[model samples]
Target: MLAAQRRDLLLARLRQDQRVVAKDVAAELDVSEDTIRRDLRDLAAAGLCQRVYGGALPASPAVADYPTRRGVGVASKQRVAAAAAALIQPGTTVVVDGGTTALAVIQVLPTTLAATVVTHSPTVAAALAQHPAVEVYLLGGRLFKHSVVTCGAAAVEAAQAVNADVFLLGVTGVHPDAGLTTGDADEAAMKRALARRSADTYVLASAEKIGAASRFTVLPITAVAGIVTDAPADDDTVRRLTEADIPIIHA
Candidate 1:
């Protein structure tokens, strides 16, 4: 019931759920929403959590490291991955960007599906390596340590050689005005090249990623042909994308 106790409890909940809503915490701790916000702010200042709109999220979710990213958002990524994987037809060359979402797509790839997958993420390459029916092409370049994806001039050049049917882009943020953005400059550059080389580009994002903006811009909304998310297509966000002329597919 004390401030320190409440803060500790809130952090425990955030660790377990990956995020915590202010209203829920307020009710549980018999405090006002403002008080919960103060606690969140204090926690964030202490480097204990990252505050989101209505709540706080764990400072580091999956993707902080390769091993940690493997299981984060497993169900949602699986659904998104399944849908993205289904888009690949026989004999198609596809480019999967470097993100946990794209890695999820690789994990659920059907044994019957056949295609050449181009990616810069070591995690994704490792996943696709187990698939005998798929041809995996690892792009070479300087490795981005946080995401464990290759980027730089070499990787960009390697992406230019292939004309892919689809580029499955993993977005850190998707806003109507900001379009698609990411947190890394090198990754953004690589994604831009992948989009240019592919005939069609699809963005895979979770609901939380919608309306968010990161530090680096990748592609604009018009550049993406479709967006696949875990939420239902009838959600307001899906309708917004539909109105904007971007096709929305529910995972």
Candidate 2:
């Protein structure tokens, strides 16, 4: 196929599947993996896709909006969220990061628990507001249009001031070596600040995020006290994390 036709085909597949693997494209198009990689690089350069370790995802999924993302992995996120929320104790301060998974955690919070929730996510703050016993503190900063989360220096500073019992961090990608990373650099920075200010930090991830890497690094896996994921506890991935001394709570 011609270069233009090949690029169009690749983009169409990405739109349909939300991701594209180089090997799959190369085999389908009868081209070398290098050719597929070059196509992906060009697409990424044009801001049409975000290249990942072995594939590429749509530059920004349509559900990049907080409310939309909240519905994407509703079941998995709820399971993970319930597990994370169970760790919260009454009258303790908690920091929730911005992600659909974290929003799920807020949704399942008990109505009777008394606590303060500091967050950069407007969606999370809105969810927590429904609980009469919880105090929601929404940080101020530049809003990220796609995620609808406040980020930047102001948000980071606000996160640093609150000493919380736990910080439930949402990760874009978590690998054994790459640790934690996010698509947005500012969000990663804010998460790091939240981790540093909290007494304990727990990462919430889905099975797909494991073994993945993103653009910006947040912290090493060892930095977190625990991880809550939808993957099986005894899976090789979870076992590796457990061996590192970080407790794994499989939902």
Please name the candidate that would achieve the greatest lDDT relative to the true structure: 2
Question: What does candidate 1's lDDT look like per residue over 1-251, in tens digits?
Answer: 88889988987886455568999878877789999999999987775666767887655333245566656667777788888878888899999888788877887778888889988888888988879899999999999887888999999999889889999998776666556877679889999998999999999886656655555679888888889887666555466778888887777
Per-candidate TM vs. native?
0.73, 0.76
Question: Candidate 1 at residue 6, lDDT?
Answer: 91
For model 2, residues 1-251, the per-residue Cα lDDT tens digits are 89899899888886565568899889887899999889889988886766878777655332245666665667877888889999889989998888888878888888899988888888888887779899988988999877778889888877767888999998766666557777778878888888888999999887656545567789998888888888777655567777887778888
At residue 35, candidate 1 shows an lDDT of: 97
Clashes of 2: 0
> Model 1: residues >4 Å from true position, as ranges?
1-71
What are the lDDT scores of the predictions, listed in order?
0.79, 0.80
- What is candidate 1's local distance difference test score? 0.79
